[model samples]
Target: MLLCDVVTTSASVAATRSRLAKVEAIAGLLRRAGDQVGTVVSYLAGAPAQGRIGAGWRTLVGLSVPPAQEPTLTVAAVDTTLGEVAVTSGKGSAARRTTLLEGLFGAATADEQRFLLRLLTGELRQGALEGVMLDAIAAAGDDTVGKQEVRRAFMLSGRLADTATAALTGGAAALAGFGLTLGRPIRPMLASPGESLAEALAMGECVVEYKLDGARIQVHKDGDDVHVYTRTLREITGAVPELVDLVRALDCRTAVLDGETLALDDGGRPRPFQETMSRFGATVERELPLHPYFFDCVHLDGTDLVDAPLRERNAALHRAVGDALVIPGVLAPTGEQAEQVLADALERGHEGVVVKDLDSAYQAGRRGKAWRKIKPVHTLDLVVLAAEWGHGRRTGYLSNLHLGARDPDGGPPVMVGKTFKGLTDELLAWQTTEFPTHETHRDDWAVHLRPRLVVEIALDGVQVSTRYPGGVALRFARVVRYRPDKQPADADTIDAVRALLPGAEAAGRG
Candidate 1:
């Protein structure tokens, strides 16, 4: 495929604000990819490659030569290369990396920059495409024998580029034997909320654990080998060597555990959420140490616990790490007990509590009622009436969305907030494809979609603001989910939304 293929697909996907469309386009190109190496090279060389580390990046070059070739032969080789094009080239902090990218890839848009960043950062917003790649390998091989060979090569190599190359040169067995990478759990998952403990219990009798105020992480260890990753799968192995050392000392020979990392306060309890985040980046004080609190075991001693029940996984978790590495607290007998724990946690300055169902299986990348998060009174039901193009993982999808509440007097729905969080690739695609029918108007930056699509929104707090027509803004707004059972006219009104405001019941109800 030509570089134009990626460019055109990117433009169309961006125009429509659809993640699925962009992913499908990329997948289609990969399927028809005759010269896979050349295709990757071309895509990376042009528009997609000229941004910061996490966004869409240009195709990689220099692989044709020996791996030990001079630095100039590598894609990041020349000082003139885009990544090397310093953001503050003779300028200061005001000149963003985006500005540098625009200077180099004049044709690329903000959306394009976002895509390149994900590629470079290996965030790969396109989920399950690796599985598709495997299928493509099977189809591209000479015969069943050749396909099997390619699969095996991929399984052994454990790297994407190597897997693709093996299929092109070796065969399918290379792909089939593709093993799960370290720090990548077989049943990774996100959480969804239930209306209350009763709704959660309806699923089954579950062991509820208090959600801690910490960073979500996955830890992988094999004998002396150890690695750790964020929820998005970015390797932060260098950030917390203490965790690596702790997991290495565990009894299990090979184990994959899910948990949280936190920065403790002087009292030896968790600190603020922002403080935990600050521990990231290159310059965090290592001696201070981010402590990990293990919870679930996805893989233990060469056995896959992905399909196992939460109870089984928990049992495995205890056996693998013992009590030393797991989070300090244990199971609560009831919601009242859980509430007491939550109160104690908040008193210690923790954000809130997370309640988990004991029998729930790990559902990768899906947020459902299985694992519910309860923060302070900080969530809302808002409507999406308009959307704007987004960069990075959401470049082609309606990444940033405009939210609103119904009008009490049957007037236009009032705008409440805008958000890009609480969304998956699947949700992006669904909204992009479905939002158009509700389109009322369009501007270069945003589409004024018709009033519909009620989505529950989680918020940090309410603040008065003049920017929004509603005279307020929801801080840290995120989509909870599409309340499909709702109607546009049935959405909560601005009056109702104001009810969530503090100490203004008279004004809120008015």
Candidate 2:
């Protein structure tokens, strides 16, 4: 199939708001993809099969190539070209890459050029992210392959491209063959924010675990060979050799442990999040010795516990790690008990407690209601939509963040409000350097960015508003911190923000 056909389908998907229409368009493309299913799916999902190629807005802005008068670029040809561009590096590689890109873009049509630009810069905001693409894949798969099976395979493999290829070629049997590989990283299970301890406990009997203010680490261990990954699945095995040592000393031979790691002060109290981050981010040599706290074990002793209940996973974790490394948790706690757990965590300089359903299975990559995190302050994980140039003493820096809440129905983020508060000089400098890399477009006052950066914003409440698309705005919003651990898909939805509004329940019923 031609690359133009895939690009045209993506355009149609973006133009329509109807999920069914988007699915149909994508499903048709997948059926026509034939042998190029993997590359086609990857492109339609707004990513290159070759991944990040070091190309940025700076390289593409000034270098414009004349468009081709005809649509003749094949999907396999584009994929091969991108692969060449990605592998080109070292001395004189920049000039070589630019020449390759110029040739490729010059051969593409105008619409194809726009599509290539978006795909390269990672700004293809068509509202058809991995979740929607997964649905479309299921729709296009053979009748033997169930949607649940496809989802499970995708979660286990951590690559939609691989899943799509398997589903297309080998059907359900190939997809079902995907299992918890010892070295591969599976998506971490996520938690939604709980309104209160009472509200969280009202669900059912819960296991209240301390929510540590540290970097999330998923350790995959097979004897001495250990690999560690961040929440976003970036491997950091070499940065922290201490963590590798700790995992190597574990009782189990092969295990996948999910937990947090942080630097603790001399008094055994958890250090500031920034201090912990500094330790984790260190590359040359590790200064501080970081500690690992194991909470859940997804796999142990060659057995996969992802299908097992939380109770079983917790037991497996205890059996694998020493008591000192185990995260503290209480089973079937009452409302008062849950509150005490939260208080204890806060007193220990921790974030709060995560109340989890005792019988819930670990649903990787799904932020279900089974686990709820209760923090002290009311905070929302919002996407950074844009930023304005600073003034006064803050000149030349990006300040005044424009925040948006995620749409519940997989649409673009609904702009909630803007804030210039809670930013330190360090954060301002970082934003100034970083925001432009993610820039989609810019005007005189502000530079719009791809909705990718997730920021935890502390807010007093939500008020009905006409200024924003969500019909509600954040009141007294201020940045708590930049959540490098989260993605825009993990941001709090508009309905979650609406739940904070006064009389929200009554309004919903009405």
Candidate 3:
């Protein structure tokens, strides 16, 4: 298929706000994709099949290649070129890559060049609109394949490109081949953020597990060959040999265990969030060894428990990994009892608790009410430093807020973090109207404001970070409400923000 056709179809998909219209447009593209269906889907999903080719705006901006007048590049050809560009490296590799990019860009028409730039630089992001694309893949199946089946297949495979090809090709039959496979990482099940213990307990009869502040890991063991994957499905098998060794020692011949791994302090409390994250990279650290704690067993000794109830899965988990390694939790607790569990988790220096419905099956890659995370809401009265103009659906709104904590010495507020989360339409409208009144300066990206307005912000916690002037950054911060009653002087101090870092006595995990 011509690259121009796919590009135009992507534009059509992006131009529409209606879900049905987006699905139909993508379905049409899928129908016409033929053998290049995978490549087309990946591109529209704003990911290259080659994945993160060492090219960026700085590398491409200098290219002076003239655009071709007529459309002639094919999707397959572009994919092949990008694949080649990704692997080009070593001595004088920069020039070699530029030559290749220039050749590819030189052949493309002006419109195709624009699309290629968007595709290469990682700007054309439609993956966030992935639900519509999944629907489109099912729709293109001519009613032979159901939406749930497609989603299941995608979740199991952890690759939308593969899902697209399967759904568009042999319909349900192709997707049926996708199942629990050892060594291949499936997307791990995610927990929905819970409001409070009482509210979460009201959802259903549930098990509450201590939500440890650690990295999510999915361990697969096929005989001696054990692989550990992150929540995003990247294998860190080599970096975390302790995890591999621990899983290999399991009595089961083959198993897929979902859990969290973290580094620990001398007191046996979990280490800071950054220290734990450090173990997730390519390099193994002897000083920062990661300890594994398995929670859910997906497959064990050839028995697939993915479709089983949580009660059955927990039994399987205990049978496979033993109770010593399993995450501590209570099954089917009352509301008051669940609150006790949350308090216990907090007192132990853990993040919070996750209330999981006992009867719900493991819904991989989906965040629903099956499992709900109840963490402490850490709020800070932070001064609004600036606001970035929004994009896409939030185009006209002043969306992302730059937050600062009051410097105790009183020089200036220290910039801590930025967040656009939890803002309602009413809040966005209010920001647009109210922010300009406090404006000190303006830039193309954001409107700078006088540090007079104090906004109440809720965060998961603070982590050690060099990105902020305060040497700490807010994790998962969102607007609680505007603290119009408070002044900048009344805002939380930078010392207060730093004290929230995990491992500090004043951090208050509970």
Best by TM-score: 2
Off by over 4 Å in 3: 126-128, 282-285, 378-510
Q: Candidate 2, after superposition: displacement of residue 474 in Å?
A: 0.2
lDDT of each: 0.60, 0.88, 0.83
Query: Could you estimate the TM-score for every candidate?
Result: 0.55, 0.95, 0.76
Cα deviation in Å at residue 488, candidate 2?
A: 2.5
What ranking of all candidate models by TM-score puts the best one first? 2, 3, 1
Candidate 1 lDDT, 1-510, residue by residue in tens = 333455454444334424344445544655555555423422322222333442222332111111221111222222244445533454553345445444434333434434444344433323223333444444544464343444344433434455565565555444555555555533347565434544554565565555676778888897898988776456778878788888888888998889988888778787655466555554555756788888888788988776688889889999998877766444635657766766776677665566777777766644556787666656666778788987876777877888998764334578988898878887889878887766767888788875657787878767777998888788888876675434554466676566556655456348
Q: What does candidate 3's lDDT look like per residue over 412-442, in tens digits? A: 5789999999898988998999999777689
Candidate 1: where are CA atoms >4 Å away?
A: 17-27, 35-176, 183-188, 282-285, 328-332, 379-510
* TM-score, cand. 1: 0.55
Off by over 4 Å in 2: 391-396, 408-410, 505-510
**By the TM-score metric, which is better: model 1 or model 3?**
3
